[model samples]
Each structure stands twice: as C-alpha cells, then as structure tokens.
Target: MTTAPLASNSSPASVAEMEQSLEQLKVANYYLRVALDQVTDGVVIVESEPSDPKCGPKVLFSNAAAAMLAGADPETGLRGLGLNDLVAGDKDATTLQASLQQAVQNGGCHECECALQSLRTQAPIPCKWRVRAVFNSLRKLLNFTILISPAQPNAPAKADPKPAVEDLDAQSVQLRKENLAALAQGIAHDVNNLLGPVTVRLSALIQQVQEHPALAHELQAVFAGLKRAKQFTSQVVTASKAVPRKHEPTDLSALMRDTVEFAGAGSNVHVCVRQDDNLRLALADPVKLSQVLQNLVMNGIQAMPRGGYMDVEAHNHMVGGTGDGRLKPGPHVLLVVRDRGCGIARENLGRLFRESFTTKADGNGIGLTTCKRFIDEMGGEIRVTSTPNVGTEFRVYLPAAEGSGSTKPLSPADAAPVPLKHGKGKVLIVDDEDDLRKVANMILTRCGYEVVQCDNGQDAVKIYQSLFRTGTPPDVVLMDLTLRGGMNGTETAAEILHLDPEARIVCTSGSVTQEVQMVFLERGFVGVLPKPYEAGELTQTVHRVATMMKRN
Candidate 1:
C-alpha cells in the first residue's frame, strides 16, 4: 500500500535531543546576530523548515530591521515566499527550485549573490532587490528559505545585553562591530611601533655616510638595504587595520608631547606642542594614542625629509547641536599636528582616508586610514587640510572630561649623555647581522678597545667560555636581543652573568616591544643599547658599562 510521506519530520528522538541543545543553539544564535550587525558589508539569513523553534531560525525570527528597509514591518509574518518570488529577475522559477532541490539533496545548502540570480526572469520587479544565497554548514540550501537584503546589508548598532535580552537580537550586530574596531586599532599601534626604530636607524646611517665620504660606496649598499626595509615597513603601515580600544580620561596635550618626543627621538625633527595647563582631558588609551601621534609625526618627518619643524597642539572646545531643539554644549578637546613641508595636493586630499591610498613614493597609505578608524572608535573625529607646497595640518577632536582639573607636572627629560674617552679595554660585541658585527668591531678597534665579535648567541657563549678558560675574558659584552640560530641576546646575557655575577652585559636591538624590554630590566641587564646605534652610541655604551662594572 502506497503511504503519503507522513508530513516529513525529523524523528521524535532527534527532536528531543535538539530540544536539549537549545541553550547552546541560543548562544550561537547571538553570535550570528552579532556578525550580521557588526561586519563592514551586509548579511542576510533565511531559515525555513525549522525543526525546533527555540534552536532554529523561524519565520517570525526574521529581523524586522531587514523588512523595515523594504518598507514593511516584520511584526507581520511572511509566508509562502520562495527565493524566486522575492526578486523580479527570476525568469524561470524552475532553476531556482532546482538549485534549492539540489541544496536539500546535498545535505547542505549554499549559494552566492551571483549564482542565485543566474536563473530566468518571469516578471519585471517594481522594487530593485539584491538576491544572495544563504548557505547551511554542509553547502545545502535550507529549502523554502528566502532572505531579502538591500544592495548592502547594514548591521545595527548593539545595545547592552544584560539589562534586556529582548533587545539583544536588535543590537547583537553592533557590539560585534565595536569589537572588530578595537582589534584594528591595536594592530595599527603595534605596526607603527615596530617601524619607528628602523626609521631612526636609517637617519643615523645617512648621517654616518655624510660624516665619512671614504666609505660612501659601502654605506650606499647598506642604505639601499635600509631603504628596502623602510619600504617593507611602509607596507606594514598600509595593511594594518585596528579596532579602537576603550578610552579613559587622559591629558591629551601632555600625551601628544610625550609621544612625539619618544618617537621622534628629538633628533630628526623639531617637535612642539602647546595647550592650556588646566584644559579638560580626553578619554583615550595612552599607548594607542601615543602610537597615533607617532605615526603622524613619522608621516610629518617623511614629508619634510630634509628635516623641518612640526607642531602638535591640543586644547578644549565646546560642542553644541543636540536634537529636540535643545543645544547641549559639551566638553571636547582638539589636538592638531601641523608640518610646514611638501603638502598634499587638493585632489589627493579627498582620497587620503582610503585604505592603501598614499602620495609618497614609498608610502603604503594605511597610516591615515588607521588613524581615522582609531579616532572613530574613540567616539571622536579627525580632519585634515593641506596645500601643495606650504604645509599640512591634522586636527583630531576628542571628548573631554565633564568635570575635571589637570594631571601632574611634566615627565622628566631624557638623561644627559655621559662623556667617555676611548680607552684600552676588552669589548665583546654580539649580533645576528654579520655586517653590523664587523662594523661594530671596526668602530671599537678604531676607538682603541680590543674587540671580539660573535654573530650568534651560541658562538658568543662559546667564545666567552674559551676566553674565560684562557684567562683573557672580555670586560663588557653587548648582547643583541634577537639573534640568528641558537640562543638569543637575553639568554647569552644570563649565561655571562652566571660566570661573573657582575657581568657587564648590555642588551641591544634597534626595536623591542616594551614588554620584552622590561624583561631585560627585571633580569638584571646593566642597560639597554637599542640597535641602529651610532658609532658614538656604541662607544658611549661600552664606556658606561665598563665604568659600572668597575664600580660594582
């Protein structure tokens, strides 16, 4: 006897188990909703034949926000709608139906925005609609499911979930957007910090070439490598996208001064900033904010490659323009960085904020884009005005403290350089770069110190041991943080300290993460000697280490 397909259902046992997993499914649902709202582009979800109402997408679960775009209230349910019915371009509903059938047959459903619209059209659409296929985990179409999104999906801003779960689906997407925004900001900060020292070293190398024209050809090659490195750094600055971070009340003017000084090294460019000592503070992360300032300052330096003055200014301003015919004057602080150098043309100004858009021959163009992202995350805004040859200025607006005073006095200045004479003492140089090791060796030897060079940590350790055994141990060791093959600078330093508790080992590298630098300090390294060291910086460092050694 032929039996009618008993209305097709997932068996009772499977249904019961799915019912048991509702809690887990609900959590997953929240995340999907979040992605729907927070992503840059759009997302459309269509669910049909849901076995469990709590765990699966229901016709009623379709977000009203989506329908609102189509000029319909989602509170009223939609029924008997097929994928082809939603769009006018579906000339042959058979093709769409066949694809849907295949999706169900495959045990997974899938379709992209293009493939779903490849079918024949039966009617002219009164409404312009963009059709995209919604897919299941296994690349199958959940039969009878239809989701209609505008040309682009616009995720809504998220609201707090704790106070109200009913409003969660409405705002789950917005919170996701915020999270991604913060991530982008962090990435930008890290990338800029990494590039800072490389730029500084390039500057120092150029000065060296100018000082001694005898080594011009050799130094030219080195400069070429450094130039490539700079280009590599610029690319990193380009692709870096970061999410904004949580902002707290901070002294914007003071922070800008500190950031610029630290990154500028006050050597390549003249940095200046001014503000009211008692002006209101801004809510921003000091580290991230510093990274922002550093990137801007770096850009300013590049614009004025011959070296020129750059100014950073910050102050408080009142903002008004609240709806409901009411004016709400709020405390907002403005920070400006201006450089009198080769400026951007009017045409380039409009496209400056776009990703990978740059005017410099070596620029990757991510700096301004990252800056804009960060500013937006902090609940602020950034603007720029530039002339072709005169100069360029960047202005950032940040929310300020409603009721406030000021932070403490200025931070201490950089320590004065200690004077030293070329002395006849044993100096050990450890580095991963062979060229650097040889160059350092030559510099130290010229300065009248007996020098021993090691290209890696293991080699340095072996040489140090051989010397100790031979009773001719070096007086001081310059340890590089990152080394080629075997132990790193820190490990080598630790081994040397094992032999002599008062080993005068100076940790060296052009750039190190602040956290990694701190590790050296905690582990008792005498001092840090950052890389791209000038011939003089190396001499001074050795003299200081020797003096400290004798005293200890």
Candidate 2:
C-alpha cells in the first residue's frame, strides 16, 4: 500500500499564508492564557498518558487562581503536579480519576465533588470539579481541563448567624468614640461663640477700669478666668478633631500653672505649683501638652471627692543611658504631679495606661491612654506611682529645648501686654451674633477707627457694594463664616471680590479648621481670625491688614 504525500499539490503562496495563520494562532493562545489568569475560578489542565500505566495524569498548565487554591508558589504554579496531590484523601482521588476516565470515554463533561488540599497548610478545602476532555480533530486526546470552584454548603449549615464577640465589641467601641468626638466638636463651637463677646467685653472693661486699682484687679482676675476657659475649649477641639501638633519651645512652668488653675477651677482641690528657678524649656506642642496636663489634673481632682491639696513641681534633669528603654538620653524637663486622694489599687497599677482599662464606674478609659500617647509622641515618658488609700503621683519627662539655659523666662500671661493698636481706617464687622458685633464696634471705635456693623451676609454684601459705589469702601472687612441667611462668609467674599478685585476680606469662624483656613486663603482672603480671640489679637490683626492695604 502506498500513502499519498500530504499537501503534494500545495503552492508556495499558500504555504506563506499558512505560516501567517500559525503566528495568529500563537498570539490568540497567549491572550487566552492571560484572560484565564485574571479570573477567580481555578483552571487546571491535566495530561493523561493511558498508554503508559505507570505515568498517571499530571498538571499540563494552571493559572494563578489554581496555584493559589493549591497554596503553591505563583512562580512555580501547578505544572508537573500529579492529580493525587490536588485531592485530600484516597476516596476523593479515586472519584476524580474515575470522573476523568468517564469524560474521556464518553467524550462529554463529567462533574464531581471533592476536597483540594493546600500544599502549604495541608488543609482540605471542599470544592466542586468539572472535567472536560480536549482532543484534536482526529480524536487524538490532548489534555483534560478541570474547573475547580468552592463547594456550596448544605442549606441547613450555610452560615453562622451570630458574629464573633470581639468583633462586636470593637465595632461598638469605635462607634461610641466617633459619636463622642462629634459631640465634643459641637459643644466647643457653641461655647466659643458664647465666650467671644464676653472675652472682648472683658478686655474693654479692664482697659476702662485702669484708673481704679481695686476694680482693675478684680476685672483682671475675671479676664484671666475667661482666658483659661477659652484654653479649655481649644483643648476640647484639639482632642476631638485630632488636630496636627505644632511643636515649639514651650514654657513648661507657665503651662503647668495655667493647667492646674483651669482643672481645679470649680473643684474643691487646691493645686499648688512649685518650680525650679532655672527650669529649662521643653520642645513640645503647647496645646497637646496642655491637654495632657489638664487630664491628669482633673483625674487628681476627681479622685478626691473631699477638698485636698495637690502639688505640681517642675525642674530640669539629665537622662542617662540606663533609664527607660523608650526615652533617649538627653537633657530633660521633669514635671511631677502629686495628689493626696483616694489612690489607685496596687493590683491595677500595671494596666493603668492600657487602652479601655479603667477603674471608675463612669470612665470611658481613653484619658490615660491618650495622655501617654501624647507624651510619647513628644519624645517623652510618663510614669505613675500610687499607694492604695494614700496618694498617687505621675511623673512626666519631656525633652528639653535645644540651647535653652537655666535663666527664668516670663510666661505668656506674666509678660507685659502690648498696647492695643490704634489705626485710622474704616472697618466693617459682619456677624450673626448681636453681642459679637456690638463688642467689635465698641472696641474698634475706642481705638479711633470708624466702624460699620451688619448681621447677615446679604446686608454685608449690600453695605460693601454701597460703600464701593460711593468711592469710600471700608479698608477692611471681617466676614463671619456662619451667617443667618442669604450667603455664608465664603460666598459673600466671592461676591465682594467680584465687585472689587482688591477687596481686603478676613475670614472669622468659631471652628476654623486647617482645611477651612486653607480654603479661605486660597479664595483670596487677607487673613483668618479664630473666634474667642483676645482684644489685642483682634486689633493687631485688623491694624496689620488695614495698613498693608494702604501701603499697596
């Protein structure tokens, strides 16, 4: 018998076309492999050698999903892996082998269920398998394609209805914390607005009562009290909003005095601060450190239901290499707070700084944790010592400012107050609060400047436009962020700038976050003045802006 040569009559041009077609098939196969690798379902092709009984089916090719399901390295994939390696037990392996054989014999797909064992974990995961035989046109077997998928659980045991206890508690704590932060922010805003007018009016009163020493002293005390209240509100905003800290050379002596006074304002605790004459300055964030100090002081006050004395002392010290592992050895400022109150129990001392651990019935257990976090961030350490029913002492060590010597410096309050700036320029004060507008008007008028007032954004726009029409627009405009109607401060500023491109507008708000300040500044505002500001700060900012406008 003679066999006819294949393609004996084929032309050269046909051979070229066939080569191009083969290249296209290769490109198509590459894309198909890429697509399969992207899918989540595991695809594994196993080659069977029925002619050789010793060589069973082995993995011909596998995608990423298959390698992951088998817990094998992606680089090695599942190539050369035997069928038995993928199955968990002998029974499952036998069943899979039978399904493959049936698929080959019938030339149809076969389905079965088995568990795939992970090579790394050696753990069995229940999965469904679909076997399809691949063959050439002549019916010559190529490979068996298997699709592996996670098995669907029986209806009676599908899922666990109850969540884990730890997960539920964590979620509850997080929700409560978020709610508390929101509440604190709201309260701080309202309190700042309420305190704004009082702070301004008290400054004016203090200036007016300078002729009477007795009255002046009393008014000064009240003014100091108001200042402390404002600081407390700032601390509230800082704690709740998680404001980024701005570190500077801080006067620790002054901060301790102010914090102790503010924390013991309404309580029966008497806080006495003793400081070294030559205490060094601390390189720290003033607001955050003040918050920490206030928390400790308040905790001390709360510990003593009855009236008692607490001592706060500050001095400079040098840390050595053998101290606590966390702190770096360097010049340090040590602040010690001691209180004679119902002390903490000995058994609970180790967990004093642990998160969500508290002894008080009404405590949320975040105060000490926050305090420790703040101190740690400032490159400091805070330690506690307590004896049951005796007393408790907290020692805080802060890194000293670079190049700061032992010469005593004045605190912010102890420093001489700058004289209120006197300038002659037309000013417009716009605010929704009646008392705020009135206080600003009085203060500016006393400083020898003509002042105009408006309650809402609409009137503010009208007044500014009218002034501009008359060729005598106000030199500076203080725009309140929150207005009763029409437009807010930002919108009003935009309208004013539309009428006059060179409008000198200042943004004022009780809640002037960093984002808010940046937004207003980008919109061409000249300055930002946070609410509850001192009279000196208000006059200084306004005078500076008005003068700059004239200079231009």
Please write out the lDDT profile of model 2 over residues 159-243, one tens digit for every residue: 6634444444544454345446656766887899999998887776677777998887667667766776776677676656555
Q: What TM-score goes with each of the models? A: 0.40, 0.64
Query: In TM-score terms, which candidate is top?
Result: 2
> Of the candidates shown, which would achieve the greatest lDDT relative to the real structure?
2
Please give the CA lDDT of all the candidate structures.
0.59, 0.80
Clashes of each: 26, 0
For residue 124, model 1's alpha carbon misses the true position, in angstroms, by 51
Taking all chains together, the TM-score of candidate 1 against the true structure is 0.40
List, residue by residue over 1-552, the lDDT tens digit for candidate 1.
Answer: 797654457799877787668646755765665554344432344454445533333333333333333222121212223344333344434444454455555544534331222111221212222323445677555434344432322344466434444344433444343333334333433443354344334434555555676674445444444433433333332222221234678877556654665557645678777887777788776555666777888888878878878898887777876621121357777888899889999989989999999877888989889888877767778889998889999988777765765755664321111222476779888875766677777767877899988787767877888887787788888887756444557667788778767667887764433334565777878777754445557777787777664632
**Model 1 residue 147 lDDT score:** 45
